[model samples]
Target chain A: MKKLVIRSLIIVAIALTAAFLTNLLRPEPLAWIAGAPYNIFSDCPETAQHALPLKIGNVERERDFFVDARKAAQFEAGRIPGAFSLPYDSLFPADAAKVDEIREAAGGWRIVVYGDMPGAKLLADDLFSQKAGNVYYLEGGLDAWLAAGYEVEK
Target chain B: MTPKKEKLKTILAAVGVPLRVYIGAVFIAASLFKIYEPYQFALSVATYQMAPLPLINIFALALPWVELVCGVLLIAGFWTRANALLISAMMLMFICVLSVALARGLQMSCGCFASQDAADEIGVHTLLRDFAWLAVSLYVLLFDDGRFGADGLLEKWRKSHA
Candidate 1:
């Protein structure tokens, strides 16, 4: 029994070590780890950007670095003027090429995102950690921008 | 030891993999639900009011990651013993939290299934469910039931190679 206990402890220690090393090697294991709690707390409607109202003029004085997190169909219908469209799920850190593309477009500028509200914030956090410049979320999403009478492209 | 005792141990070892898989899948679904809605999970943690704001936020954010990583490991049988132990520890934590809520008569959700349509409310059912899950986890911790796992296959391969 003592031997069995020791062996089990050793195996557990090795496994934890491997997990630590794996996370260390990967740039964004946080994406995988941080997802659980979010799914539990939100109702579907609350997650939508347009569902919640936003703070006014949250994107003033920002450069042309807005990324629309909504789907293509949503983006084509309407979006903040001069904002680039990069749907949320597409921004995984493993996709280095896409990250580079986003980095190049938003060069030396504040990158603001808004989907339906703060739904974009989690995506922005992941992108910012990957070195996207100065990421922000329009306090209220596209609806807020339109509500504030800001310029929007159809 | 008696023959029956030996036989039972063998049976437990044989059935370990399926049991582990069931537990792992549960954690995976639970964790994924929370991950898909992090802010909501954060709010749930805040509602508990046991920990301070900053601590609660960080815990709310990271706990799901632990569950996911460990759950995946458990499923893949990559690190069965470690993941089993980690899950057991997590179950104990949950039991503590659920017990407190029960004692206080706090009507809050257990936050176990983040994507559920129900509000964060707990009662006798939640407590019983958590205890049951905890029992299952404890059983896994005590037994290697690694039957269909990669860990079992690897061990077999190693013996053959040796």
Candidate 2:
């Protein structure tokens, strides 16, 4: 029993060492602590690009990086699968912090924002201005996504 | 030992080796791609909305290596029971995560192998697959006894020396 425990520990140590060493040599090593969440979201909508639900669905079929700009309550009710929630009336600290986390983690991915109102447009422009590349808004928001027969995560 | 008990041991000893190799190879295949792209794996983990953001990167970084080491050890049949237990635990964790993701209607890939954006999305089939692996791991954990492996050879050598 003692030998088994020791062997398991050794394996874990070796694995950790290999992982860290290989990661360190990468040209763009990932942050040890991702999204050090300590920023506020306050960007305004400017030049927000728009896309139809079908187009966005087709483009991001595999890795759909959607950002839901609906209210927290609405988001809780239902949302596009894998979509990140960043309700525009995000006066709460949690929502604001989420914006910060998304800004950091979304990285170079094609981020598509959607909502029933202009919140999606505003959030997309905000993210784009914040250097979030390839940011766009959904033409008809969740309704469009549903209309296109995509499942929602509730 | 009783005949029935001895017969059971013989059966387990016979089957354990192949099961270990199969599970080990699957694990090694699963880990390689994850190790190659920790960042994308992190994104996939985040998509689950399970782990906190701060922990996602580290989980992505360490998990693949854990899988790799356990896999290699299982294939080598060194500490076979321990490696099988580890694999079983990982499979259980995966099964639970997949269950929640599917229940919540998540549409992300399983991220078990290949890229995070692989066509194999999380679904009932993925859950069933993990459950199958978990069953194999449990069988190995219960019946493996240094047979057809380094452990078996070491035991033989020890008995001969004694």
Candidate 3:
């Protein structure tokens, strides 16, 4: 029995050593553990670093058109100077040509997108995938702009 | 020791060699891949969701080295019984972890073998595969097959003494 216990202990020790060493050799355990299946692990886009944050001081000149992808009432009350209204739900208007219209209006200039909630980033990624050129986010959206010394019309 | 007892020990030692060699070869292969692509292997380990966030990096660094050492000892035929038993224990632990993860309904990768090749989501299927390896190791304890090993020398000496 004593011998058996000794042997078992030794085995346990070696196994543990192997396990620890294997983990030591492995690099980024958190990412592996997170278990997100969809996001193909890819290098962060180089352009992401260069993309500027949108704000009122430069919202008009910097962006081709500021899209108030928020509720209609919110848009009517106040938005970036010279900004056009396009609520989130109404983006895919039945007309179908609205995509073209938005595209043409946003031609040759960056489109700054803002929304009322968190889905804004996903929408931005999708819009960028759909060939929206030089897209930027307002960092904190209109809320942040409002907090940072900018006035809303309403 | 009694003749029967001596004989049993000889048989146990004799059975251990080839088992160790085969297991060693596998460990070496596993170690090589992990050492070659440490970061990728770490990511796979993390995907398993077993270790805590802070310690994942440390485990990633240590596991490959352990495999290499254990592999080399098995291949060299040094410490045959001890290494065989060690490898067996490791396989048993793997089986347990795989089983628990499967039962929990967590979709993850096994990260047991050389690569997460497809990032093949580990499930009940992976648990069975690891159990198979554990069974092989347990079998080695009974029939070690240590023909070309240091343990074989001990077996020969015991035979002459009897």
- Which has the greatest lDDT? 2
Cα-based lDDT for every prediction = 0.63, 0.74, 0.60
Q: What is the C-alpha lDDT profile of model 2 across B20-128, one tens digit per residue?
A: 9999999999999888988777766776678887888889899999999999989999888888878988999999988887898864332122233432466788888
Tens digits of per-residue lDDT for model 1, A1-154: 5644565465545644654555456554433233332333332112332222224543443443677888889999988777777777743542567667877876544566678534576666666667665566667677777777777888
Which candidate model has the greater lDDT, 1 or 3? 1
User: Considering summed lDDT, which 10 consecutive residues are worst modelled in model 2 chain A?
Assistant: A38-47
Q: Model 1: per-residue lDDT, tens digit, B1-162?
A: 999997897788657767777888888888775666655666666555565544655565566767777778778876577678778888888888877767876543321223233334567787788777777767776776454577778889999999
What TM-score does model 1 achieve against the real structure?
A: 0.49
How would you encode candidate 3's per-residue C-alpha lDDT over B59-150 as one tens digit per residue? Answer: 55556666676678667765554556667777887787677767776532211122344246666677777776666666665566454565
User: After aligning candidate 3 to the native by TM-score, how far in Å is the CA of A76 from where it should be?
Assistant: 50
Summarize candidate 3's per-residue lDDT along A59-104 as a digit string, tens digits.
Answer: 5444346667777888887887667666666345312354456567
lDDT of 1 at B90: 83
* Cα error, candidate 1, residue A28 (Å): 14
In the order shown, the candidates' DockQ scores are 0.05, 0.21, 0.07
State which candidate, 1 or 2, has the greater TM-score: 2
> Over 4 Å off in model 1, which ranges?
A1-154, B1-6, B108-118
User: How far off is residue B72 in model 2, in Å?
Assistant: 1.4
Ranking 1 against 2 by lDDT, winner: 2
Give the winner by DockQ: 1 or 2. Answer: 2
**How high is the DockQ of candidate 3?**
0.07
**Top TM-score model:** 2
